[model samples]
Each structure stands twice: as C-alpha cells, then as structure tokens.
Target: MKNYKLRRLSDQPILKTSDVKPSVDGFEVLGAFNPAACLVGDEVILLLRVAEAPRGKEGFILVPLIEEQNGTPELAIKEFNEPAAPYDPRVVTLNGKVYLTSLSHLRIARSRDGIQFTIDENPFLFPARMDESFGIEDARITFLEGKYWITYTAVSEHGPGVGLAITTDFKTVERIGMILPPPNKDVALFPQRINDKYMLLHRPMVSDIGKPSIWLAESEDGVHWGNHRFLFGGRGLADNPFAWEGAKIGAGPEPILTDEGWLLCYHGADPTHSYSLALALLDKNDPAKVLDRSDAPMLTPELLWEREGFFPNVVFSNGWIQWPDGRIWVYYGAADSGVGVAELVRE
Candidate 1:
C-alpha cells in the first residue's frame, strides 16, 4: 500500500468461521467473508457473507446443493470425491455443472472503533425467497432517500444475481427481491442521485462466455435497471495486463464522492486468482464517463494472513467509512479467513 496507511488490524479476524451460525441445521461453518459495510450513527455495521456446508468424509468433500420437492426448495447434501472434484476449496465442479461447495447467508457485525466488532450470531439475511435459495453474498449499502438501500449478490442454483433490500432501522429490513437478473453481481448504488437519476456501479459477466468486468447502469426508480453501459474493461485475449487485474474485475466499496470526481475502489483478480484492490475516478455528473483509472493496485496480498487462509492470495475490500479527518477506514477480507482494516489519506 504505497499511498495508504496500515492503520489498525483486528487482533484476530473481526469475524471468522467460529462467529457465524451454519445456514443449514446440520452444516458446519467454513468461512465468513466479504462483508457489506456502512456506518450507522457511531456504529459501523457490516453484513457478512458466511459460507457453510455439511461436514465432509475422508476422501470426499460434501457439496451443498439446492433441490425442489413439492414446490419447495430445500438444502441437499452431495459428496464429490477428492480426486473427482475439480475446484479449489471454494468452487467445485461435478460432471459438467459448476456448484459452490457451501451455501452463504448475510449476518451483521457492529463496531464503534472500526477494529473491534460484535457480530450478530444470527443472520441478518438468510435464504428465504426463491431468488436467494442458495444464499446471499457480499452486499454494498447506499444511504439515500432517508433510508439505507442494500445491493447484494443473491446466489441460487440457476446463477448469481443482484438483490435489493431497504431498512430504516437495522432491526427490520424490507427485501426488494431480484433487481438485476442472473449473471450479474458486485453492485453498489451511488450514495446520492446523479443528474436526477440513480446511477449504479455493477460488474456483470460480459457475456455467457466472458469474464466479469465493471459496468454502469441507470434507473429512474432504482428497481428497474436500464441503459446498460460498459464502464471499465479488463484485459483481453491477446493483451498484456497489470498483474493484479488481468483476469477479472468487480465493484468494491461504495463509491466515495470526492471534489475531483466520484472516487471508486474496486477489486481485480489476476489469472492466478490473486485478488487486489484498485481505484478509479469517474465524472460526477456522468459516472459512466471514466475520468482516471489506477495503473497499478493500491493493495495486494502481502501480510502472511493475507497470503494464507481459506483462499490464498487475496486482499479484498467489502466496505469503508471515511472519517471527517480526511482519512478513509476500509474493512477488507483477507484470504477469506478474516477481516482487516486500512486507511487512505490525501497523498
């Protein structure tokens, strides 16, 4: 991190596998990662994605699957032999179908100092609607219209899509269901209305056969997304790319409105699956217009905790709180094993 300060890191993971309850009754907690963050008054609230699955046997790993019986979806457990399963610990492939090894749910964690956190033992969002039958993943929050609107990745057997929810008090939430259809995720709304319309930063897989890349879409009413435009493109087939962002890219913490423009921090993955943090600047009036983009990553997997864990070689930001002192507090997931914090100040 050349331009930022490594302010405070939690004594341990602010939240970890041990902190979350399994999504299914008989399952086990595998990891707690990629929290959606926002500051509520003096408290910082994080909607954490907790991954859980049934315990596996000696020669096989148990895969969680969603099945329908009598018009109702239920959790089904299946085992894929270690030698037959073609995936890292996170994703798995059986036959010709790709399946996530565990199901996920969104749980809340609150903190005052930004380093120490008290995570809710119960989930803030579970897989209820058919749209989120598999579960809910990373969420980004936007405070607008006097309420907190949450845009999250809703996963199911069909595919990963975007889901919305709103809350006045963190105690109760109203789910708006699927806003953007399947094959889209990593979505966050601009904190304020832009040019009298709502602008959102999202990463939709370019095509059925393409990799994930950042995109911008607008809405008159926040629910119906239209006017799709590609905002940022990652490396192409024959192009040389930055080592930290050559393979894929996605929207990260909610956009920060700076005097220069809208400061956006995002995550990019290299072909080796190394995930790093980067930033970009967009025109305030027209966010679809990119002003300046980072040539190199701001942060990479450096520390031992960042380089080793459930999924190694990753330092990904989920949410951030900008202090009035001109310092930005970033809460990120390290190797999907725990959470860490970083600070960015005027350079």
Candidate 2:
C-alpha cells in the first residue's frame, strides 16, 4: 500500500534498555522482544522483549535485571565457560572472549499509566523444551469468553511456526502445542467466533507458487483449523518496484472490530528486508473481503535507534491494546533489539 501514513509517538526510545534489568559480569541488556499489553488493576501492563549480553558472544545466555550501578538497566550473562559448548557466532561477541547468544524471552513490566514502565522481577514466559527451543516472539492476546488466548511464534531449529497458549490468569499459561506448522506464521484469531466458528488470518509461504500472502481459515474449535483460502496478494507500485509486499504481509494484532469494519494492523516487508507496519479494513462478517488498506507504512524505521540496531530498518509488532479513550497503543520491537510504543487514532 502507498497512501497510508503513521505518526511517531516518541521520536526517541521512551522505554529503552533502561526500562529492563541490567547485565552483570560485563554483559548488558541488548533489546526487547515481542510485547503483549493489557489493562490489569487499572494499569497498562507490558510484556517486553529483554535481550541481554555483551557485544559479540557465542555461547552465553543473558538474563536482564535492574542494576543499581550507574543506575542503568543491563543484562547479566549465564556464562558456561565450558570448552565443550563452543560459542555460536550468530550472537554478538566482544573482545577475544566468546559468549553464547542470548535467546529471546517474555518478561513482564507494569505502568500505572501507559507511558512509563517498570519491569517485573520475574519473566512471564520462557522457551519450553517440547517445541519452542529457539524462542517465542510476537504474541497476540485475545480475552475471549472470559479466558485469555495467546497465539505466538514458537521457534526452533526446525523452523518458525505459530503456537497457542491459554490462560485465565496471566501468571500461568497452558501450552496448546504448535497450532500451525512450518512455512507459516502471523496467525491472529478473531476475538469471538462467527457463526459458531473460529476465524483466523495466517500466512503460508510458497516460494515456487507465488510471493508470501495472507490466508484465511476457520475452525470448529480453536485448535484444528481448515478451509484455508488465499485472502490477499501483493500489488506492485511504480516508485516502490518491490511493492505489494516484496517479501510478505500477514495479520499483525487481533482485529479490532469497529463500526467502519474490522481494523487490522499488519506488517509488510520489502525485498530489501526492511519491515514496516500497515493497516487494512476488512468486512466485519466476511473477513475475506478487504475494504481498504494502507498503501504506505503506518510505522517505519526513521529514528536513529530504530535505524541502527540489531536488525536495522525494522519495526515489528505482535500486539496492541485499545483503550476506552479511543486511543490504540501499539507496542513493537525496534530493530530486533528492544521494544517501543506508538499511539494511533482508533478511527
């Protein structure tokens, strides 16, 4: 899409590494991960991405903490210092010493308002051995039928896919295994069932058939999904040769049902690997029909920190919370390093 636009809530990082725990033993907090926000006890609670460690490490795992030293948040690495487990080059390394790359984990942070936040002492979610060996990213929380449903990316060496977790209280989560398998991601379930059936937006990658596009599916139960159909495809633009989502486009957060239609915040990536956020309006009943979509990005990497980080020129969001005050608060990961927030007009 080309004509859509977005406004920056905070030009600089409002909730940066300072909002998380600090690093110990020469390690430091790097970035935050997939953020899930909700209203708890009249407060906006944020599930932030807290990636920690020193620059250039291969084998160490960094856990974030709030440190008194320099009064700055940093990461503390769990050093193996073992010769057998060699360092992985994929993670950052500093000096001549090698540290293992830290995997992404979900940590809780609370704010009386929504702007300033303080991280919880403990993490709300971590990688489970059954399938999420790599890490979990991008979680969409839907409070449905008195229960909260979380759909997130379950990563492993096998590949990245979508997984389901249910919870009545945010403290405990019950795993529902991988809901969707490899070569697919960006799954968002409708908050309520339509015609007694569950609806979801998913992206199934087909390298040979065509470019990655959005698909719609329905299920009797939330677990098993079927009736998959291609919902939308990329459209090319003159200025943006790699337009129509040069790479892919999928549902971002849960669809916000409004009088206009179903407002969907989605992410689109170009061939150059730059990722940005966009919006689409779908028919309330027949989500397969698109009413309107943003031609340009709603959010992009323009800030200095957003342009210069782990993965430059990237702004990805897993979830957003709409307040009763007609404000939609968007929480996204900036450059894959840390999390940031943006507010948009609900209408």
Among the numbered candidates, top lDDT falls to 1
Weakest 10 consecutive residues, lDDT, candidate 1? 1-10
Displacement of the residue 311 alpha carbon in candidate 1, Å? 1.2
Error of 2 at 133 (Å): 1.0
What tens-digit string does per-residue lDDT give for candidate 1 at 6-95? 444444556666766665677888778887788888888888878888877888878876677688876677776776535567776666
TM-score of each: 0.90, 0.81
Question: How many residue pairs clash per model?
Answer: 0, 34
Question: Which lDDT tens digits does candidate 2 get at residues 138-162?
Answer: 7777777777888877665556788
Local distance difference test scores for all models: 0.81, 0.71
Note the residue pairs that clash in candidate 1. Answer: none
